[model samples]
Target: MGDEVKLFGMWASAFSRRVELALKLKGIQYEYIEEDLSNKSDLLLKNNPVHKKVPVLVHNGNSIAESLVILEYIDETWKVNPILPQDPYARAMARFWGRFIDEKVIGTLHRAIIFEGKEQEENIKEVHKELKLLENEVKGKDFFGGDTIGYVDIVAQVVAFWVELLQEIGGLELLTKDKFSFLYEWIGKLQNIEAVNECRPPREKHLEYIRALVENAKSGSK
Candidate 1:
């Protein structure tokens, strides 16, 4: 018998969307369990004992946490339309960029949007620098790994979506046309993909959520 697959996720999380995109891209049929972060399910807590995070992929009672790891697991297990390149060197490069964005860019963007004062300014500049580096890294490519949408593209799509939402929340336009032309164009291309379009939440809904989050952060409440 095939392994029973279930994904624990939050609808609005980029990490959750990353796994969802990977599953859809690979044409994997699985149950999607929407988790309330405020009241995380017992199964989720058990599956991901360390992080207690969403986007946990459980297969045949074996659970994997972290979006990037889950994406790789999905790609390797399904092996139909491959998300990562077959060549070892190319796959390494793809993994490198994915990790870089996860470690450097996303964190910077989060800090810039969620915090205020000097720390936020520092984070904004740091995120801008990272985007500049990415612009150079993806100079000639349609996607991060060239013409086709692959692992890097999947990672990028979620990040770009959150960045756009954060832009609205912060009421500032950091990713302007002149500053990062390549990323601007790339985000448009990613947004137009059918899978992306289907899974993405409405922009207004995201904005409303962010507004509430900002209010809560200000008041220091749960």
Candidate 2:
């Protein structure tokens, strides 16, 4: 009858949440399939045989792996509420910041939380460096999109939401208001968006999961 849009995602994954936010913003009705990463499903395996990762989008039996690719596909395909900017240069800038967040910010912040001794300190410094770049980008803007949550903001859900929760459970500090004032406020703004807010995992349960991860990291380190 209509487009068969389906998303395979893990609840606590920020990457999966990005796809969900994009879909919601574009008013695209789709079925969301929750994935158990530990023991992935046959469909998920078949869809994303390469990486075997969650956040695989299946549109009319065609599967697309990777969250960034899925976001672009959704935006291009739907074209209702544009997740990315219209201008050529603006869209490029959005993609740039999104890539920067994925490559530099997310991994560094996670390592900063999970590592100990000299490694943790180094990762924390890297986190600050990476966030300062984002802080500069968000300067004089309400959101990364400069009025609403757009692609960069959606991609940075890890920085906005998960980092805060991880920081709380990990007993570490990276995204501080004093250091990155704009990003702190940006986090508040991003979380306030109805669509973005709706895609988040329950805070308590997520914290519990993060705590387990931290404990496991500690055990493995020893």
Candidate 3:
């Protein structure tokens, strides 16, 4: 394959990791450029001028920003190990859920993790409300993609891993096995995938980073 694939991303970002997982799942070889988000790179800024975020995928000199967009591009560009479903409606649902997770679930989950007392309680309630929808979605399936990991599963990396650690730091009980058993089981299945598992940030390093964030939030509140 003469195609050139490159990913600009931050190590700790779940958004960045999803792109990595897509590339890995598709068996695509590419260069990984680790970006320092504190000091934005000229290339990242140029490629993704609007968002100026990490996880800009450059293929053969064409840049694609946004994790969900990049995943679809990867799936379409490389025919191997299809990320989205073959059925058009299923694919649309995958995209829909992927967007819902990013727009609705993730931010609320983060708020649930950082805020304390009443705010945190309210955010936690909101998270449970959103996740119950997901829990119901995954009730009878091994994954959102049915048996195999697909677009929705890849997009849900945050739900599978980071939130658990965030809950630990915040002393929240958001995703307990009893409450979201199917979603909990789905998380396990995603974690067990070697391709996806390898793309995750190191557990200890990730925990340390999140702990520092919580500390910073606490200090800022004072």
Candidate 4:
């Protein structure tokens, strides 16, 4: 029997983007189900009972949650274009960088939007520092792993678009080419790829969505 593949995701989710890119890279055909995060679907909650989060990949009636875990599953299921490296040590490095980007870079950037004054200033510093570490990693390569996109590339993709959008909308300067030269250039390279570009959320709509988040936070506090 053919596998029934479906993806539960939100348009503006960077985590969702990771799963989409992995499927695209492997040339897998699957249904894309967009979820309204505020009012999540029963399907989403049922599939991902633990976190009630997105980027859940349903294949042959089996559901996989969490973006990183889903990426590994996708790569293992369909090996046409490998997302991970073959060597055990090399694979370990790729996994390390992926976790680093999520824990350090993404969290710090979110903090920049959430906190203010002293807290925001600290977050901004941490973001720059984390980005600097990533910049050094990509100093002499086309991407995190190599010339082509891989697991680490997908994980680091938030910087490919999210950082730029946040900077424009929030009037914050982060991930500038002047500072993170290779890392900044790397974003443009990743964006230029047809697969990555196709899955990217439309900029105008995404801006509005993110702005609403900030506005809602402001209103809630007041």
Candidate 5:
């Protein structure tokens, strides 16, 4: 086995897609293992005892968990078409924006779309604030990394995709052309990339899945 690489992932998970996109960008070959969240596989639990989450990278029998961590690992191991910037300051900036999207934007969107009542209102406001910051960050830049599709760009793209889905499900469009011109432009630029285009799931299918999840969540809460 010459550097056999395997990825355990769920089809709809943003985290899994992030890892998949990174691997494809770097031209790394890997086997894809689809895991069911309802009935997680034994191998997945064994590989990631702590989280038991998807997007686990298994390289030559060594397993790594967490999507962001796995992306860095793939970049380091492959070293071709570098994802993170080489410059220290630029790398820091990229990492900062990545974390911002993961923690602030995505986290808020999850709450706003899935939950109800006052909590949803608070989360919606928080998400709006985060989106404004992201819009400012993308001003005058083709990509989040400024003219290159790098780590920050990857994180931004993932967040944008899920945000669109959430907005559709919640019947509230937050990032429109008028409100977030820079972010709207940034998302268009990101979608034009061959790597991003190839890995994206169909919008109709994604929306249907989100609608079902939202309905299920509402029923559970009632």
Candidate 6:
């Protein structure tokens, strides 16, 4: 409710989107500062001195870094629309999956999309395996945290949006309704929520951006 809540982030970053989504879901009013990652702002550097990363949530002059950490901070600071469950084990499970999505799923998806030939193929296999484990974590619930789009859902913004576009750009069919049906249905459920949809970057724009990344990587290799 205070004008003190400020978010320093980039529009296209999945990590940044998670914090933004959490803020929106919590109904917390926060001022957003767009950081030019190539040339980071002094504000970002000053706030998150160690990492100098975007998606730093500065609340009441206190700075919190790392999107997943920020998500938990937002949930704790704002009582309403609890992003993490109250139950201790349930919260731990949600945090576990959120970390898994960030640490495992996203990295595998990135390599699978950007690499080629045997490397890409092998990475894709890993992506499938990792996704299946994540699907099992859902346990037939609409969202990882029961009916609400909570911690895990916010962390998985990449899978729900960017990865789908990345797959098409790479000419790979990774998470289809047929292969990763649970994840596919989960993506549909997450995207239907206004907070998630609004926070996610446009599919076409993200694809173009990723294609440019691949081209740059090729150029850098030469």
lDDT against the true structure, per candidate, is 0.84, 0.89, 0.90, 0.88, 0.84, 0.85
Q: After superposition on all CA atoms, what RMSD does each candidate show versus the true structure?
A: 2.1, 1.2, 1.5, 1.4, 1.6, 1.6
Per residue, candidate 3 scores C-alpha lDDT tens digits across 1-222 of 598989999999999999999999888899999999889999999999999998999999999999998999999889998989999999899899999999999889877766778998999999999999988888899888888888998888888898889878887898899998889889888878899879989999999998998888777875
Q: Estimate each model's TM-score.
A: 0.92, 0.96, 0.95, 0.95, 0.93, 0.94
Please identify model 5 stretches exceeding 4 Å from their true place. Answer: none
- Candidate 4 residues 153-217, lDDT tens each? 99888887888888887788787878888987788789788999988999999999988887787
How many collisions between residues are there in candidate 3?
A: 0
Best by TM-score: 2
The regions of model 4 sitting more than 4 angstroms off are: 218-222
Instruction: Return whichever of 3 and 5 wins on TM-score.
Output: 3
Give the range of the ten consecutive residues with the poorest summed lDDT in model 6. Answer: 213-222
Worst 10 residues of 2 by lDDT: 213-222
Count clashing pairs, candidate 1. Answer: 0
Q: Write the per-residue lDDT of candidate 2 for residues 1-222, one digit (tens) a residue.
A: 999999999999889999999999988889999999999999999999999998999999999999988999998888888989999999999999999998888789878877889999999999989999999999999988878788998898888888888788877888888988898889888767899889999999999998898789878877
Query: How far is 178's C-alpha from truth in model 1 (Å)?
Result: 1.8
To one decimal, what is the Cα RMSD in angstroms of model 3 from the true structure?
1.5
Instruction: Give candidate 4's root-mean-square deviation (CA, Å).
Output: 1.4
So what's the TM-score on candidate 1?
0.92
Off by over 4 Å in 3: 218-222
Q: Which stretches of candidate 1 lie over 4 Å from their true place?
A: 218-222
Model 2 TM-score (2 dp): 0.96
